[model samples]
Structures are given as C-alpha cells and as structure tokens.
Target: MKRSEFIGEFDLDAVLTELSVDLDIRVTRRMLAGACIGSNPEDAYLSARELRESLEWIHEGENEGKVKLTTILSTACDDFQRCLYYCVAGKGVVTMLDDLVWLEKLLEARGRIAGHIYRNKLPVKPLVNPYVAAEPDGPLGRFDPSFAIGASWSHDPGPDYDSDDRGPGPKLKG
Candidate 1:
C-alpha cells in the first residue's frame, strides 16, 4: 500500500519513519521538511506527522485490491520523489514543482522496494490514480502537458481510452 493510503491518518514524520523502516531508507525529517519550498518548518518541525495522518485518511478512504509489485514500485518511487510536494501539501502550502531530484530519489526508493517485492513475490496491482502533471493548454488546443486530474480513475478503464491518461478522460490540459 502507498504511504499516502497505508497511513494517511498518521503524521508525515510518523509515516516517514514507517517508510524508513518499511523501505529501509535513511532520510532525515529536516531534509524532508527543508524540501518543502514554502514550509517554514517551525524549528524545522516539518509536519511529517501530519502528512502521515492525512495520507492515511486518503488511503483508507480508497484502499482496495492488491497493489501490484511493479505498480507499487513505479508509483511509490514517484511518491518518494514527490514526497517534498506532499510535505508542502501537508503544511497547507500550495505550490508547483517539476523538478528531477524527487524523481531520482523516487527511483532509488523504488529500487529498494523492488528488492522487498522480489523477496515477497507480490503481484502488481492498482493502488489508485497517481498525481500526474499536464501540460499547459492555451486558449486553444495547445494542451497542458502538466494536467494531473482524471475522470473515473476510481477504477481502471477497460480498453476504451485513445491514450493512457489513466482513466477515461477527455482531452484535458492543466
């Protein structure tokens, strides 16, 4: 299960500790909180605790099926990289980021998680619609490559989408 969903009700620090234990990674909350672009992190508090709680709620509200090993690796890594954004979100700071550092860290975390999945032989399954960015769409059909929303991603589509936009979504732009 994803950190967001597995323990969404926990705080970011709690969740981070869980992930560190669960995924065998070494990440400092200070670093994670500092990663927040706008979070002052009051004494570097970096509400990792709050993040875990919220994500737990989010995940509990939408947990179902077995999260595929490959899928989890793919998405969890994405989250690890995107962890900074989530931290900001947890801190009630709304901002945008398209950086590669998160991706790299995410990939690294994925590699580590992959080892666990291999040892456990878990099946790849859908957790939920991951956060994706759409491009910018001008007044016309220029399209925003950073669009991150979707339609009916509540469940995977059955071979009807013209493209892999996750769910059956129309032409959308950020």
Candidate 2:
C-alpha cells in the first residue's frame, strides 16, 4: 500500500498478495482487516483473492494465542483518518476477532482477547488452536504453520489482570 492511500480503498487480498511478495512472509486472509468484523468493504474483498494465491500453509501450535492486526491505514474510509486494528492469530491463521465489542464501541480489542496489558503488551492468548487446518505443498517448497483456529481460545481474566502497579504498558480491565 502507498503511504498516500486509505485502508478502505484496497481489499485485504490484494494487500496480502502484494505484501507476501514485498515482505517475504506469508499473509493469510484470516488476518486481513476487511475480511472480518467491522471490516472495510474494499479490503475484505481483496483479501479473498490474495488468499487464493497462497493456499499451502498450516497452523503452528502455541502456548499463547496471537492475532495479526492489519495496519488500519487501508481500512480508514477518509483520507485523513488513521486507526489501530485488532485481530486474532493462533494455530497458524490470523482472522478478525469480530465478536469483541472493543471495536464496535470504539474500545480496544486487546484486553477483551487477553486479560490486561500489564506485561509490556497485553496478552490476548487463545485457549484453543485457530489455524486453517490444511496445507498445499509446492515443488521444492514447504508448508508454513498457522495459529488460532476458533473462538474457544483465550487469556487469563482474573484479578491479576487488573493490578494498578503493573508497570508502563497499556493496561486492561477484566
């Protein structure tokens, strides 16, 4: 994506395809911003196409869940709008955490996914594996792993999450 364009302009598929070539890292639609909840229409559509190109990746297991946030630059509809996006990643796949109300009410999705940000970054660990659950191999190629297969996974949501003296990272309430 160009520095001048809004996130809403491009689809996630297109960006991921271009990004895969540019970053040398495989990007799945599950992580693309527009493909999930509260997504920009354009970005979501583009993501589908990008996913079609690279169809041979598998999910990697994890002790904690991870989600890939698509840079909010493309999802912003206005030229001057900029925002942070949240997503779910685990089991080798990254997708939108649409169910979380954080984005709907203009809240942060990090705390909802994890308990708090007491540790530098809030831990939004998933309870289960959320990977694509499949793979396609290329000649002389390898199958990449994925993450976060479904909504059943999560992080700790107990009293430890709400400690006031947790440090300098962003804090989240249960």
- Count of backbone clashes, every candidate in sequence: 42, 39
lDDT tens readout by residue for model 2, 47-131 = 4323221221212333221212222223323211121222322311222232222123222232232223334343322222122
- Superposed on all Cα atoms, the candidates' RMSDs to the truth, in angstroms, are 19.5, 18.5
Candidate 1 per-residue lDDT, tens place, 57-105, comes to 3334423211221222234222433354333232211111111233234
Alpha-carbon error at 102 in model 2, in Å? 4.0
TM-score of each: 0.20, 0.18
Candidate 2 lDDT score at position 136 = 18
Relative to the true structure, candidate 1 reaches a TM of 0.20
The global C-alpha lDDT for each of the candidates, from Candidate 1 onward, is: 0.31, 0.28
Pick out the ten consecutive residues of candidate 2 with the lowest summed lDDT.
Answer: 63-72
